[model samples]
Target: MENSIILNPEKITADLYPKKFGKAGKIWTVILIAVCAIGLFAYIRQLNKGLVVTNMRDYVSWGIYISNFVFFVAISLVGSLITAIFRLANVEWSTPLTRIAEIIAVSAIVFASIIIIVDMGRPERFMNLFIYGRLQSPIIWDVVVISTYFFISLLLLYLPLMPDLKILNQDPSKNSRFLNHLYRIGGSFWKGTKEQLKINNKAVTTLCIIIIPVAFCIHTVTSWLFATTYRPGWDSTNFGAYFVSGAFLVGAGGVITAMYVFRKAYHLDKYITDLHFEKMGRIVVMLALLYLYFNVNEYLVPAFKMKKPEEEHLKELFTGSFAPMFWFAILVGMIIPIFILIFKRGRRPLPMFIAGVMIMVGAWFKRYLIVTPTLLHPFLPMHDVPESYKHYFPSWEEWAIAAGSLAGALLIMTFFVRIYPIIPIHETINEKNEMAEKK
Candidate 1:
């Protein structure tokens, strides 16, 4: 008996077309807009009052904004994981996931850029980076790679949508006036000719090749921003690999979360099936284990050596004030997820979603642990500063803005789905036909 899954082309098209937002989606959108408004107000206040409105001081220069930036960068790696790596490896099951991952990547990177600007109190001075930017600086490297990655990710997203755009363009009943305009503007020329198809395929493949190294560079440069510093926790050669590994883990977790949400919201059981969750669950576990290995390497050697310079910093993470966050990140982010997904039932959609949330929340706090603790234990003793400088916590403004930025990112993704098909209708149909033929 051939146990192959088959999909009908017309049914697939009907099921996957972009639909107007339902009640739940509309409520979600309104909430996101409100949160973004709050964030905007907070930012205006920040501009008026300066960074003094926040708890960040000399000892803890980078706070929630930087942590948020790092989290965005880490989660954005899912674009490469699903679209580039899986596509290049010829994985068929990921077709439903590529667009999801790409949108997540695009949204995350967009906010990553915004968060960086948020960290810079004087936004106008951002131009100075171009005027006085030095090749020698890691910050410049980060800027270059992030810009390059964003464009490449955008193109990766747009290229795959061209064929689908043609589908939407031809079907007058499927598109609204606004969406029809968008489809025409974006893909009026995509006639699905043999030459056009060949060119598009090559373009996507070439981009897949190019983006892998650029994605690596963006995160590696980010890691360099810390590893190059003289702080005890930050000064290690293992930082790059550790950051990359953790990024992959968080990105995978993000994908799992999206998979469950889209599956439920769109009633996409036939498309994003339980098998998809199972396979993604396995990938998450593998990434969790890999990141766990790096965590051991990152912490164990330093703890074992216990050098005088690192003792206080290591102690803070292991048994001191930051110990709670550190262990939560390790256990909830990596360990518990692994244990959950290791079992057959845990790979189900509901459990996978819960595990994904844990990983993301844990990773966010992990970033805080990465940036704050190291700065707090500076090599030089603190003197002549306000006592508030010794302790660090984000003020109400910081919390509001961070929440708003996050809400805004989700809103962008939500709007994108409302406007465009979350899955690649053309690609999914093609894959279905190919699988049927093979069977």
Candidate 2:
């Protein structure tokens, strides 16, 4: 198997090296930078005015920003899933993808932090979250878990890179000063000594054990931000599991999408192979079905009762203004992907990419559903506000900032792949050697 992978020091060096932008890559970088800049401009305007610039009011206090934050936290869980869960379970095929998952985790979690800060009405008084932070508040719980998750994810991404960084630092001819300096700073002390390996092994094991629960906590606490409220769609016993399962699904979907893009652009076909995508398709299908099952429970139980609050919410979802987005999310995000994945052809890269897009896009709407509809069905009638305030649509500033955050995450991932190996070089080689031994 090692022989079959056709390792070429030069090909690996050329293909995996931090590339100067190709035309498309350059164009993509420009577009993302432009969007982020616009988002920054809009956000500055928002800061100058207030959250008053946007459409949200007291009734819908938590709108698209909260939903988008949840999306980031949920998807960040894929890092733990691929890097920790698969590694602990000794799943060999997942080796190629560990860094992809971990990088996504790190980047997503990083911006999860940023976007939450952006969402704050009082962005300037931000230390209030800490200065007057309440331990009992789910928001505080979120702060705790997100911080812990971030460190664990950072270590998860970094520990695995030592060997590769050491390799990079040794090349005297590589003229990129920043990266060469970064490589030295990252791995100058990493001699890959037996003791260093042992310490690294132990640290990774500790993080692996620790991150699983922290991962659950991050998403669950995120759900709790809703469940703790006495709102219609959010007030349920099932919210935690439903969110966690869906988080795993979307996180898996995100990683799948990122994996395809990275594999294509970096020409890492030999490293991040087709088998990984097939297996990830199976994983996404399982998670999607699980989440859909929970969605039935989440909706049907209250739906069966036709309770006043839930009745209004469910009706809005089924037949009112929100209906199209709701059904589109359910069918496209969950049902169709599950059905398609059952066929082998559908799990191939192209169809899998299509399915990945559906899962991600649908997951966005799903997060919106989790947030807005419930707010709309507030226990108190939404009165004493303007007509437009009664029905929420994002303002242009909101859209720019939201779109910017998404662009920012993608930009981070793109820059990361350019700087570091998107696929783990040491791990992929080790897996190949192990397979050769077996053969």
Candidate 3:
């Protein structure tokens, strides 16, 4: 008899199907929901009392909220990095992680939009962007590109889930009636016929191509929001590339972090193996190195000149009030992770998870460093403003709102896992078939 295949459809289905959340999962979901509730409450308070509730003043008008927005936009780049870029490159090993990246992208972008509105203070004025917005504004560009990227990321996510949805719909007995209904609604027309698969594949390929440029545009436009200004720190020709590189680095870190968590929580070791972590480890190291190179260019050239305006901004980050955070974000975000992931043993799942967490935390503070310090050190000296306006710190409401937005994103990923196969079931089966045939 011919040698048996490594992965049969039945086993794949059973292993990869979405399962009901157990006690720990339930507790986690509840916590995320609670955090979201707190954030919503904070937002309500901000609306009622106005922007004065936050620490934002004339000197530091852009506070942690903008930092959070930048962080979300950075993290959202992972979808294009893993899903579109990897798919177009024919990177087969990445199949298991694509959905994870896409969902992260979708959720991060969703919150990016929400947080920008939060930053606007007067939420009702948002509609003015559509009605009276000028094309000359970088803010308008950001609005356009981010919205476009969200839909493309959503489609990329939903299209791949169609085949898996059809599989779930076939056996309603295994899942709740509500879930069964959702599966049916999502995949009712997906007959999996040859023509349908061909069209689906083509459409996906087209989207994969389209999303790359749009993803770049989204973050590039965002960098322009700062760089276009003649402010000491923001005025740099390198800002666009600097922002894009950091975005990719954080995005990869996020996917790696998610990969480890899902593999452990869902018992997906068969699909998300050690090899996947190893490959992702390599990607993260390269990204970290690339980001470090840009970091050097971003600061070194400015430091060499040390213009009067930039002198204060750079000093504050180098050895002043922001020094600790500045170094922390640099070391933890890029340097230490590079050290950890450079060695072969460090690339293991547990170590990779540690490094991923470090990257994420470091990246968040890095954004804080990027936005807050520069605003405080504008070209013009602070006039006779209140002494409190010279320094900045987030208020309770700002913290709650920021934390809640993060929890909301996590809750989205959590609920998505509960409803759909976190790993692509049908795709994994197809890949296994191809491997077995080659043997």
Candidate 4:
């Protein structure tokens, strides 16, 4: 009842103000920062020594960095799902999750950009993509869409926060000098008048509509990055749906993970309730099945045909050296989680969290499998290259950069939660009020 719109405004405000992190939060922040620093050191070493520090060669031109990039891009789709998709569908239960999803999308996209840059050993040559880039290239399309996606995501996150910002601005006690200053800067023009509210809602609706296709474009074009290639595994028409479906699965899983963490860390159990987890669990299962369908289409058709090129590639994934990781990704990422979450009890917070972690870790390895094995099965054999070129493994520097990018994404999410209310306070209040009225 404290969160109901009928409740005293002051109490609702008290529930939503950003809280100072406790000892555990502080320690977690430190760990993330330290990991980022280590990654930075490794990047500096790479800059000094060149890509020689990594195990990459002609055969395995793409490695974990590309996989990490794919992972980031995949998880970033949550913005479209929870924010745009749910909002447009008028699913009020998702009100509390939009901000968190937007933040995750923004953070993941940020690191997606960074990891791509990291993949380009000579960062200075990045401008070549602009000056010398062809319009037909999927890479260029990716650049255009991802940049658009990031800005749109930022706007989506900011627009909903305007009312809350006005709240924080009015009460000096609610936030410190810097935060209050941010509140003023961001929401000073938002008067919450009838005209302003109408315009804001219209703008949000328009953005939600626009972002959905752009979201699909980013991952679809990303899949084209491989599919357009002549390699064995990459040469599939199903790649677009495969990548997009997997993106939704991982993005949903990431949201579930964030929901659990924020619910516990910020004592948001009142806002992000068990029912929320139940709904998200059902969503995860649906997405997992969708992804599984794509996985079957991606693999089974090729297996049935068994062309010379597809033969070795499918063998590698089915029963060869990559079998363990391949099976692990499929089983943990989709199958096991599906089975667990099929039960009502599995939709609980803890089980959902476990399933989310499994999906995420498995998805990461899935991306790795997507990029690496195909390169290993190129159209031609590696004749003159060293034995190292024949086998691909990420070097310490590569792992450091990849891990650092992941840590940095989480760090961004952590800092955002520290600064802003993870749940949309105004929206939650309105939702509770509506339910109360209905009752």
- The number of clashing residue pairs in each candidate reads 0, 0, 0, 0
lDDT for residue 413 in candidate 4, whole number 0-100: 91
lDDT tens string, model 4, 329-415?
A: 999999999998999999999999999999999999999999999999888887888887889989999999998999999999998
Candidate 4 matches the true fold with a TM-score of 0.97
Rank by lDDT (best first): 3, 1, 4, 2
Provide the RMSD of all predictions against the true structure, rounded to 1 decimal. 1.3, 1.6, 1.9, 1.6
lDDT of 3 by residue, 1-439 (tens): 1124387999999999999998999999999999999999999999999999999999999999999999999999999999999999999999999999999999999999999999987899999998999999999999999999999999999998889988998988998989988988899889999998998899889999999999999999999999998898899999989999999999999999999999989888888888898999999999999999999999989999999889999999999999999999999999999999999999999999999999999999999998999998888777799999989999999999999999999999999999999899999999989988888
lDDT, candidate 2, 1-439, per-residue tens: 3237766555655556666668989899999999999999999999999999888887778788888899999889998899889989988788778888898898889888988988899888888988999999999999989999999999888998887786676784773888878788888898878999899888988888889999999999999988998888888988899999998999899888887887787677776677777889899889998999999999888888988767888999989999999999999999999988878888888788889899999999999988998888887886577766678888899899998998999899888877887766666556556666787
| CA lDDT of every candidate | 0.92, 0.85, 0.93, 0.91
What is residue 133's positional error in candidate 1, in angstroms?
0.3
Cα displacement (angstroms), candidate 1, residue 261, comes to: 0.2
TM-scores for all candidates: the values are: 0.98, 0.97, 0.98, 0.97
Candidate 4 ranges with C-alpha deviation above 4 Å: 1-8
Pairs that collide, model 2:
none
- Name the runs in model 2 displaced over 4 angstroms: 1-4, 8-15
Sliding window of 10 residues with minimal summed lDDT for model 1: 1-10
